[model samples]
Target: MAGVSRYLAQSIVGTLRQDPTLNPLATLRAWPNLPAEALKRLNQADLSLVDRALEQGGWIWEPTDYPDNLREMESPPLCLFGRGDASALSTPMVAIVGTRKASSYGLAVAEFFGKGLAEQGFIVLSGGALGIDAQAHKGALAAGGRTVAVMGTGPDVAYPAVHKGMFAQMEASGGARVSPFPFGTPSFPSNFPARNPLIAGLAQAVVLVEAPAQSGALQTVAAALDLGRDVFVVPGPITSPAFRGSHGLIRDGATLVEHPMQVVEALGGGMIQPLPPEEGDDLSETQQAILACLNGGPMLTEAIVRQTGLSAPLVLAELTMMELDGIVKKGRDGYQRGL
Candidate 1:
């Protein structure tokens, strides 16, 4: 099996070099000489160190284990290198992507979506970058849910360095850190555009929290669109440049989403189980009134106040407390019942 795996790896590498745009599996099956030529190249290289590194990092490839969602891509990666529980890939996934220079609003929205989706049994997926990506992963982790980080660098390489701890926690928590790049690959700007598709491909839907007109998150959105994956964009303040790309996407017909459940519903809500009710059966009268106001859908604090005849300050205070207690969630549109 080891020898067969190495031969298969060589064949994929050689085919990629010949035509980077071609599907390697198809090429390998169609051209009999492809494997021989690949093996020849492999003979000339030293792979002992690579094997050692893979073993040390707990990296392995299970070609057959590629997620069904990703396999539908026009050009999915020939193989994936992953550390930790790859089973997480089989779960319903939603990718959250945004600018590395995210604002507080962007970070909060990303985290809220991440946590809410996780609570509903969806695996949150994202690039392992700073700003929004980091916050998304943190939110999922806080919820004690799995989250996969699709990386541009090698599976073993932590690109931002600051996210090294987060990556470690992901692996420990039965989530995965995955990359299609070869071992020892460094973080390069050129690698990220290529990496974006994998992030989009792994998810049933993609969400853009915040992105500038030129943000790399747009690349992922394009890939998602090409693959026919549902694309959702959070509306940002018109004055903020960080949301320019997201607004453009909405204008181009992408679904405009304010709450995470909006995303779940757009993707067909059957995949996720309903979240259990919040603890503490005894609810305050104001809390009951607020919940009553939100029965139709999400409502703003002011709207809830008007319907419940509560003061603005009291409504705001209760909403904040409820959000922390998992009784409610705040989105761009307003406050809604939590998962």
Candidate 2:
């Protein structure tokens, strides 16, 4: 329903769902305001087949019942297909978006906010992109809270494909994979940009953890501003190109938030719990020794083994766990503290 106005699209979906005998074509054609493009696309295929497909797979959200915040968008979605319980959308949401090629620091920041906000009972919202977006989802799940993924493709097709397992877990855990794109829609370059507004509109605010000057996360920021929603940015290393857009947003008056609680509290969320345990607090003595070995800065595995006087195999195993826990992150030189 590309060019169809909100008024006509909702009426059609509402009517079509009511009675099977009501001719889809006749109902669609009756709308005097229906654009030629929308009418042509709707008429070319079998509406009965389309209706049946929608009925058989997952669920559909007509415009009439869209999330309240989402209805405020400049161009609200006409319909959405979802693969999990849509009730998660009713929770207060905060959008966290960043570059697909995220840095160690960026990933840490994304996950921190994700877990922090989720623990306080806000559902994290993001596009299911790689890097930052993926970590955000993982963080919420780690906290045993819900998260939502707004997809550029349809609900049935996980576009990057590597995220199939994560998508499955999201559905099983009450989070949703939602999209306005129809089933079988491919990953088009333009589709993501088109879907950014949905992310902005669905969340109370958007947090940009990291992005380059040209990163598309900025598009969501623009959409948030258009809808009069707040935009928050997590500052990254000033010298790095990946942070240029993030810093620019800060300089131009977007709120600079250092942690998830700041965003949550600003959005009026209750403090459900204190901050998560400090980094490295739960580590074994052996792990603490490994941490001490890298006090000067990042170091190679061999160097850490030599300094910690531990076996190389032991150091490797500990380092891997550290990376996964967001305690330390591997960089070009070696592993560095994620902070």
Query: Which candidate leads in TM-score?
Result: 2
Q: Which window of ten consecutive residues has the lowest lDDT sum in model 1?
A: 1-10
1-339 per-residue lDDT for model 2 (tens digits)? 557666777778788888988887787777777788777766664545456546755777877788778788777887787778789887788889999998767776788788778888888999998989998998888888899999998776786899999988888888988888775556767779989999998998899999899999999999999999989999877789999999999999999987677887788865443432364676778878887877899998889888878887667756755665567779999998766
Overall lDDT per candidate, in order of appearance? 0.80, 0.82
Q: What are the runs in model 2 whose C-alpha is more than 4 Å off?
A: 1-57, 270-289, 292-339
Q: Which pairs in model 2 have colliding backbones?
A: none
Overall local distance difference test of candidate 1:
0.80
**Deviation (Å) of 94 in candidate 1:** 0.5
- How high a TM-score does candidate 1 get? 0.69
Which ten residues in a row are the worst by lDDT in model 2? Answer: 270-279
Estimate the TM-score of every prediction: 0.69, 0.76
Candidate 1 per-residue C-alpha lDDT over 227-284 given as tens digits, one digit per residue, 9 for 90 to 100: 9999999888899999999999999999998777788777777444444355445457
* Model 2 residue 70 CA deviation in Å: 1.6
> What is the model-wide C-alpha lDDT for candidate 2?
0.82
